[model samples]
Target: MTIGATYLGDDRCDFSLWGPTLDQVTLEILTPEPQSHPLGQDDWGYWRTSLDNIPPGTRYQYRLNGDRLRPDPMSRFQPEGVHGPSAVVNQGDFSWQDEAWRGIPLEESIIYELHIGTFTAAGTFEAAISRLADLKALGITTIEIMPVAQFPGDRNWGYDGAYPFAVQNSYGGPDGLRSLVNAAHQAGLAVILDVVYNHFGPEGNYSRDFGPYFTDNYQTPWGGAINFDDAYSHGVRQFVIENALYWLREYHFDGLRLDAIHAIYDGGAKHILAELSDRLTQFNQTATYPRYLIAESDLNDVRIIRPRPDHGLGMDAQWSDDFHHSLHTLLTGEQQGYYEDFGSCQQLATAWRESFVYRWTYSPHRKRFHGSDTRDRPPSQFVICSQNHDQVGNRMLGERLSQLVSFDGLKLAAAATLLNPGIPLLFMGEEYGEDSPFLYFIDHQDADLVEAVRQGRKREFEAFHASGTPPDAASLETLKTSTLKWHKRDSGHHQILLNFYQYLIQRRNTNPAITTGDRQQIQTQYNNESRWFSVHQSQANHSIWAIFNFGETLIQSPPAPNQTWTKTLDSSESIWQGFGPTAPQTLKGSESIKIPPLTVVLYENS
Candidate 1:
């Protein structure tokens, strides 16, 4: 049963709400007479009533306990923003065109992470649709968007969204999203939506007015924890479950990337995450398009993606910060904050072998041993990225790797991430080395909230001794500055970087040994002081070897088992806009190939 207004056809409509603490609930219709209908509550804390022939496009609000008209908790559309009344839209009007669309599995995903607001100048779903063809051509099988849930004002990172079911009105709302998804499927691109389930945004969240949606017993980074497994929390649990189903079944999202499961603290007998996983698995059983769940967690517990039958959460995959941290530290040599735990070829090699460098190892940042070895899991179960919203946006300047590392270093980062056995995730604008930063921004109307956000942001940088004030979150300039310069795709060094990224993806997909997530097929060796490494891969008697140098000077490569080899890809070649290669054009055996600084060379043995 739908939690909001459901039209039963022929001028008959049914409205339902879940409110246990309220003495009275009035449905204030803004059309067909501007009247109110009193709802009867059930023993299960549900308030609902049937109406006949209510006008279409009617705006409504729920007046609870005789005061404060609140928007629907399950509002499909909120045209007037978060504080406004929810509008009823017909869900059956749209004609979907992708009847043959079957979603790409997580193993085959070459995910591109993008924020709609910064992805295009217009920042609307309709505008985003124009770029799908280009992404498909760029070798992206899936596009994982940062959240689109309706937040306050016009601009946000979408994590501040207060309404989970409502699409951001600034980004073209419900129809906009549905149309985008339909167009994406037609282009053979799977859409994975990033969803926030841990905590609600700070402002204009009215779920507490209707019932207990937050818990006092636990605290999260965003204040109170969600009321999962608490007293009268079953209804709250249903609300979250239905909201997830709404996206997958109604909007046809191929998958969901659950935001920060580490913060989704629930100490119940059955954790909410495990319960949600069971429900999603059930939904996937009958769904036309294959549905998947990927979790973003820091708790290095392999249980997140482990099969449900193994008594673990049955998520398809998780974002691997350990992989990112190891790669980023090695590339840039910046050992600040969490990066303090990683900075050496050995750490990167550990991530390569076991998927977590800190797996039960002593962590300098956390001040304790963290993570567990995940060797039993396939490499595809981890999604690794060189840069993402968190790695860039949370910085004081929101600087990308392009700004932090050398030109050759950029290509090296691309090769390491894309060529890894794990799934590779590329942040928007990263393919072309877009110079603009992805800053954390918001458009809240509350002055007090804005000031508090500014002060809190400044304090966060003190731990790392980061200087300079972050751009004001409330300023429109902050949002405008974060927008991608799409023209970079057509010119100069930027165009070369784009081609380099495309080449990396092509090589990864074409190599059978690389595509198969088998750990035994890969061998990694490195020298921490020399800042050089090699990954030798083999499958079905075929073999390919990749050597990477991260130092600023020339280095000697490890000899190939077979002396004769042909160059497949080289980041140091002048064609990809890197410094000239230091190695010979062809090798006949046991030769020490001269590897240029910050370069990657892939050779196929004959």
Candidate 2:
């Protein structure tokens, strides 16, 4: 079926659609006035037409084979539901105020990852802006918002987004997004949006109705993979690439966190990742500030962060799940599922030495060699976090790190994450040890699909059995249990955790060694019997050491010689729940320093 359009002097309107198999196509204009126009077919089977009087703000739908009318697959705006008419949106209408805003560098970024629905009571883009000051005060350089694309319902984690181009109407639509981003920039924070390109959601996905948007060549957990290399794949790719550029050019976004790139299977001359990276680089050169791409990859392939000259995908950075797993397992001692591969002092030591835990070693849980070492790459290419959305929400019940580890352990984890070489990303409400869970919640309209989700969760955890079968995914109770208790942040234990985080962030920003981008300059020393590790970060001649005690008992470690070492930040003080003040003593040959259990200490050498 073809779509109709018309053009007038200084104002033009055109309609085009893909439906080669159909015999005829018709365009039904639903706004300004109701009218129908017959469309002409091209050699490739797409129908098109032009209307001389029609202009911007016109709403229309295309009739397939002159029969049933449907919304445009590439609709820029969807004020109504997916079944509603496509509106003509002028991308240039919104005025942006971030012309002088240069994007944040990947290495220096302190990312704050948040889901809008759960971030605030209002759960909209505008509401999120009100909280940007709090994030900025906490030293967050980038705001990584979860997906905002339109889904089937009002409540979702945004992984099930169906409309790639349209903003969720419940979240105050496109203009609301612009306002939030502009406000964030004014608050000295860059916005990095998380986008999913792997597959469309199961419900309300209508791309297939127009043309071959999916192919049977590859299968994903969601379903058939997107037709990246098949017939009409060029247009499909164009549609996605255009969407990406639209955000950068129109919305003034700083970067994008590509969601679960491993599932985006594609085999072509130029892989989609490489092409997208190249386009982003081109955009950066033309634009004022440099933009970045952060990939959420499970493959542990260093190529995701490697430079393009090395025949790599050239993403600015990638999320490091190994760091989180190692830290979480060490603190919680929960050895189930993937955590079965971790929880040893050696594992924590290895993660401290190298950013990866596996490092090409055999994983008994996976029954194979899982990952390779990323030592040669800069540490800035990896984003490390103690807790994040997936790690917390995927649990049977969304439980924050505070639930799994002690307060002392939480301090140690925060010290390790913030002072580490890689960029640090803090999950929302983690600074103050918010006790609320971030459970997997979805409000799907389809009853059968909801049942399938419930069964899927049960089956996923069936092997563990220790955590027991998770609660029904379809239950509203499960969703309610995930909401954060804002009152807890002002209380006893939670307030202490918050102070520790703030202090660590302040220390990290002031310490040159902690913020250095060069990975090769970082060194580590550990003792298997003592269950302790000390990291030395050196930039030029300046150096600082971070010591962590993983065992229950106290331990002593020698300090580096010929340096005036002072106790900069110690987690073993009475303020952090340790014994007393840890006095700094000068080192001659073997200086003894006591490290409290589950504590981290930082020393600056002059």
The Cα RMSD of model 1 versus the native structure comes to: 1.5
lDDT of 1 by residue, 1-606 (tens): 678887666666789899988999999999756888889999999999998867556789999888878999878888999999888777776799988998897888899999999999999999999999889988999999999988999999999889898899999988899999999999999999999999999986889898999899889988899999788998989898888888998888999999999998778888887888899888878877679889999999898888888988888898889999999999888988888898998888878766788778898899998898798899889999899999989899899999999778889889888878888999998999999988889999888999999999889887679878888888889899999989988999999999998988888778766756778877888999999988877767566788889888899988865647778898878898776877766776666788988899988753
Error of 2 at 267 (Å): 1.5
Candidate 2 lDDT, 1-606, residue by residue in tens: 212222233446767776656677788888788999888878776677766667666888878765677877766666775566777765556777766777677777899999888788678888888888878877889999999887767778888888787777788887899899999988889999999899998887777777788989999888878878887787677667767877777688899899999998778887888889888988888888887889998888888888888998999899888889888887887888888988777777677667788877898889999887787787888899999999988887778888888888888888989988788999998998888888887778899998898888887777567457676655666656666566777778787777788888887877778877676767778776777878877776677877888889888875654456667788778776666645454443256677777878887764
Best by TM-score: 1
Model 1: pairs clashing at backbone N, Cα or C within 3 Å: 11-53, 563-589
* Weakest ten-residue segment in model 1 by summed lDDT: 583-592
Model 1, residue 498: distance off in Å is 0.5
My TM-score estimates for the predictions, one after another, are 0.98, 0.93
Each model's backbone clash number: 2, 7
TM-score of 2: 0.93
